[model samples]
Target: MSDLPPLDPPEGDGPDEAPDMAAAELALGLLDGDERAVAIRRVLAEPGFARSVDRWRTHLAQLFDLWPAVEAPDLFARIERSLDRPVEAPVATLALAPPTKSRLWPALAGLSSIAAAGLLVVLVARPVPVPPAPSARPTAPVVATRAPTLVAAIDPETAGVATVTAVYDAQAGAIRLTEAKLVGDDHSAELWVIPADGTPHSLGLLRARGGTALTLSRDNRARIAAGAVLAVTVEPIKGSPTGLPTGPVVAKGTLSPV
Candidate 1:
């Protein structure tokens, strides 16, 4: 609900400055609340921020499991109060002498040597484990691979009617549907996956011409696997019959697992 603009580079800033700005924005998003914090963590995990992103990761991880139980408004007020408190300044120390031009080469050489030593230490401390070749690994048994089932479908016209199509993707454990057209100017369409043998289950309503992809519950997946007759019926803007399909059938299809 917060009207935060999408993160983008500010015009005219130097290349190096952009990354720092982005990091600061990410930190601000984390302070927004739980949802924004989770989003920040996900975005920071991408390839661009992989190396130096650990600081924010560690900071956010500390609060990962603490957000949900606390009420947001109260927590926000507490954080705001904490930020308003003053902090004591640390005493300054004498500045170190700047390195001379003649010392630059030696400094660079020393840094290279340290880097090489660090790499060697890492290699010696933890050698990479070799994975077995694909041929060397044992193969598992094959379960029956069924093709995706067409659970429902809709066509624009049939006796002045519209059609709806629904399919079951066993692997994804979801029900997908495609709507062809609108049947009635006022009535919306609702899709139902009726088990051939048992009770009918509502797969939720569909927009007259809008298609949707939805996941089914474990129990519904099992029912669909057992062979369900997918059906579509006309309904009010809200939905269909309180407990049954009271409207005329728009389209219906029998599903067979492939």
Candidate 2:
């Protein structure tokens, strides 16, 4: 058997056709943290993926068995009986095996032109478990920033748009929404926060069209952080009926250092 799999796949084994790359990575212990976490969840939740992981493990074991056996080096001191001369001794020195070309990298490289294609391929191959179905309730988007303060741009006017901005004082637990375009007589602009976990939390309705300030609950305030997604949705005069967004996400932005 070959010591390693082919660096390139045969025709038809393109990205669209390959689903075992992730399984190979997982079995090789290449994935880390959330990436690994997601893969593990899929391994348990997806029977097909689990089977792929098993197959990769078997193949890896075969590869190891094919590796050329290396003998350990040793050193010793010896004396000649006639001259009583000390001879060079064989000393065993610890050594590490040279890094071999990984099959994962070749597979990922052949599949994608992207730099760091392994990570991109893993991500592009499968979604990170957000964007639930329409029938399901939406959760907050992942909060990726650690900024003490955050600001966002909100412009949802389809006819005549105006500059709108929002600032969240995470420490003070206060959020201020300033709009150049006021909500119409019956329409209200609702505020929503999408957390790192990718769940949506409605902050509340914007009471003033020009500007409004409100404090978030203890639980909701904790969701304010860098890389968090802030969104504004236009709901009825009273806001969304289902608590989840019922209207389009007209405006959105990421959290940044204040």
Give TM per candidate: 0.38, 0.40
Provide the global lDDT of candidate 1 against the true structure.
0.53
Q: Tens digits of per-residue lDDT for model 1 on 68-120?
A: 54322335434434433433112111323333422332232222212232223
Model 1 poorest ten-residue lDDT run:
88-97
Question: Evaluated with TM-score, which candidate comes out highest?
Answer: 2
**Model 2 misplaced regions, further than 4 Å:** 1-147, 157-160, 180-183
Q: What shift in Å separates residue 162 of candidate 1 from its native position after superposition?
A: 6.2
lDDT of 2 by residue, 1-258 (tens): 479966876789767777647888999999999989998999999999999999999988977756764543321111112122223221212222222323232333222112223233333433322222233343443333443666655545453454345677676689876543445666777888899998889988887544678799998888877677877787888899998988877666666554
What C-alpha lDDT, on a 0 to 100 scale, does residue 41 get in candidate 1? 75
